[model samples]
Target: MADEKGRYSNAFTATLAGIADLFRKQKNAVVLSDDDVITGKNILITGASSGLGFEAAVQLARRGAHVYMACRSGIPEKGEKVMQHTGNRNVVMLPVDLSDIESIKKLVGQLKEAAVKIDVLIENAAVVPSGSRKTKQGIEEMFMVNYLSKFLLTRWLLDNNLFNTDGGSIPRIIFVSSESHRNPKAFDWDGFGKYKEYSMGKTVELYGYYKLLMTTYANELARRLNPTSQHRYSIFALCPGPVNSNIARESPAIFKPLLKIVFGIFFRSPKVAVQPVVYFAASSDVKDKTIDYLFLMSRKEMDAKATDVENGKKVWRLSEELLNQHGVVFQKSFPPRI
Candidate 1:
């Protein structure tokens, strides 16, 4: 992988470099300590009840950003915890079930009614299922929870003009991806939302597949948004290298303890792993560099086959079709980037 000189000799080396950058003295690059870049900014983050999402919410709120914690349950308590921890009374919870489209619509309605202008949106909710499970809408649980719902929500938010509508500043849309995405093949277009060979190994494999979809989405959405120019928003994905969270709770019960020990010793804890996500959220280094797949606060090139423009378009088209089938309406053409 990395040579003695610390040069990236290959994909593995590049990956290791990214992870090492994660542990560097974490700092908010956008603000000079005497200044605050995120003060008064509005951010909506999913999966804010725990793990990387929760950590990012806390850090952002601490910086004076108004964070709307969107999760499936325990909103009141989690909101209170975040409020107490950050001393940011602006932190509030909004109910959302990433596995359900109707719930997403409800969230959009609420945001619209509240006239909330979002400056940053973090699509960070995900689940790893050990078995073949389906959502209430009959989609595979892993597919629904991990990628499709976020895809739909991002598109809906943009489609309905719920973000970056004002000419104030460049809004951002960040996707939480994983380095494991590099290990997967091109997305399974036809096989998605269908249980194909179900097993623990298959589930693990599919999790990477969904992450691949998420990685490609940043590129695809960037492509769609770049042409118009005035309404261009920052779009990128970050991989918080191997966080020791409940993400793997779906694994076999026997391996749970062993997995926790191995993860604790080998991988970074969720608290530390969240630095990259937080850094990417408001970092000056990434503000104009859109459509990046980052790890450890650095941009990493994706597999060519996965980042190909044709493949990106295909992914976007399929996502639109799926969402349309579920009754979402695409209203306006994309506007120009500022």
Candidate 2:
């Protein structure tokens, strides 16, 4: 398995094995203890109420990191569970609805008031609507919560110097995207606002479209932020595979039981699925690995269209335009070069 360089000989084989490790009952291949990784780091994880985000927060907290759980609601109940289970009192619950841009701004204010120096930001919250829905701002719910809020919150954080505020330490931002991002349907950029009918087909396609947008924007955002080798922050987008989570609660009722069976048999649990996410969160090997769109355990290129620089630019400008319409102004540090 070792090459002349003393590294794994076949990258594909190594990648395959690494992904297989995620399905292991005990994560036997993982060697890093919680204390060996994220200790003393201030981490912020959105959507920490349940699923992968919740598990990741618990594990990180156990590692001695101060975990700020940015949840939409249920802070007290979830916060107490996190504190007791992780045995770490550093868990702080923050309330913010991603569908509301105003709530996002309020979230930033709360972060600043706490004087937290964010070392790691995990953009993990997302929703898959069973039918077409609109946020308070009249944007598609999935698009607003899954894609646009990510860009807005990230831009807000950067603008206010929310992360790496200790000045010298590099910060990491992880976007929990999905393999479903490969939806073949073309994005209807002009019709986003008028799209309000509830069809299972459209809802499913929109979910993928929104996830794909995350990669496109992340690629472009990385370009805008990392102008040189010495930038303070890096961005990574990854899919957690088909973890059995509530994200699919919106699926049609008739297939729910069948889908549940299939997922239970083949899909990994949230606890196991979160290992790779936490790995990327505080791992030394991930430092400076900027702008990689990845599968659960390996770096894989997103769909070719997702990396379209022109499309990415369009997405960025549209995001700013949308945010502005919602009474939020995006703060740009380094203007996009391409």
Candidate 3:
């Protein structure tokens, strides 16, 4: 019989290996510097309690950027641990629950009150609920956390003028998506509400659907915003290859042991998995480009067929409507300067 690692093998691992191989082939690509200073930059990272998001926050702070970790429980102990590990003092913790719209609003409101401008926004938080769950806003759990919440948050930031920096440039918004957007089918729009039960497989499928939606929405928002001239805010959706993260622990108990074994052998470290995001956030090469989706560290275009521009527009409209219904009027200006 195949071992646990072999049993859970999928295309995600193959794709990551291919990307690593490509990096090796490019012998002259510039390597990252350990002393790069990102001083004066304010970055906000979601899901900073652990995994890739935590790594991203630590690394960004190490680069001299002020990092705000947005988590569900603003635990000072966890924040202290991250600061100690990274040896960076520019890290702060902000509590937020993406599943709840009000929590998101309060989080942003606090940032706004502080009069801090966000130079980079990483929508890295996600949830793969084991069973069918609904957010406080009565939306599908996966969709709310992985897709809609990001969309709403970005919209709010832009509208409130929190992302606009001096000299007419807007902050960057990076969406942590997945390669699973290439799946050949669209998700059932109403199924999220209809399903009252949950299973491991169902959770994975729902999460994949959210990734698809994210990729589609990223492109559409870029087009609508059209960052040019002074307000040069751009957006990029990134597909970080699978890594040894706790995301798999959300699976059924029967599958946890198997996934743990597989992830142990085949998954990349959280630090490595977040390289693409770090590069996108700080690299000078990609500055001001309205990229659709990036794979690894390369600026690869996503499958247009999979993104479905029409569907993306529909989703955007629906999102705006949803926010408006909740009495949340988002701003339209880039970076949303107050």
Which stretch of 10 consecutive residues in model 1 shows the poorest summed lDDT?
1-10
| CA shift of 306, model 3, Å | 5.6
Please report, in order, the local distance difference test score of every candidate based on alpha carbons.
0.74, 0.76, 0.72
Tell me, by lDDT, which candidate is best: 2
Candidate 3 positional error at 60, Å: 0.7
Give me the overall lDDT of model 1.
0.74
Q: What count of clashes does model 1 give?
A: 11
TM-score of each: 0.86, 0.86, 0.85
Q: Across residues 274-298, which tens digit of lDDT does each residue of candidate 2 receive? A: 8667877867766657666556666
Q: Compared to the true structure, candidate 2 yields what TM-score? A: 0.86
Q: Candidate 1: misplaced stretches above 4 Å?
A: 1-36, 195-197, 228-231, 333-338
TM-score (C-alpha) between model 3 and the true structure: 0.85
For model 3, the stretches where C-alpha displacement exceeds 4 angstroms are 1-36, 187-198, 227-231, 306-308, 331-338
- lDDT for model 3 comes to 0.72
- Residue-wise lDDT of candidate 3 within 1-338, one digit each (tens)? 11112212233443344345334443223335565567769999999888889889878887878899999864776678778977777788999999899999998899999887998999999876767787776776777888889888888777777885678666788999876666535556564333256565556555666777787778777766763444366787877776788776556677677677767776778888888888878877667576645665555557564456577677677677776776877656332111
lDDT of 1 by residue, 1-338 (tens): 11223222333343354456456564433322323358888999999988888888888898889999999987699889888988999987999998888899899888888888888999999987777776778777788889898888887787677786476577888889876666554467786556454666566566777877877877778877777544467887877776767777677788778767766776676767787667666667666765666665555666565577777777777877777776777785543222
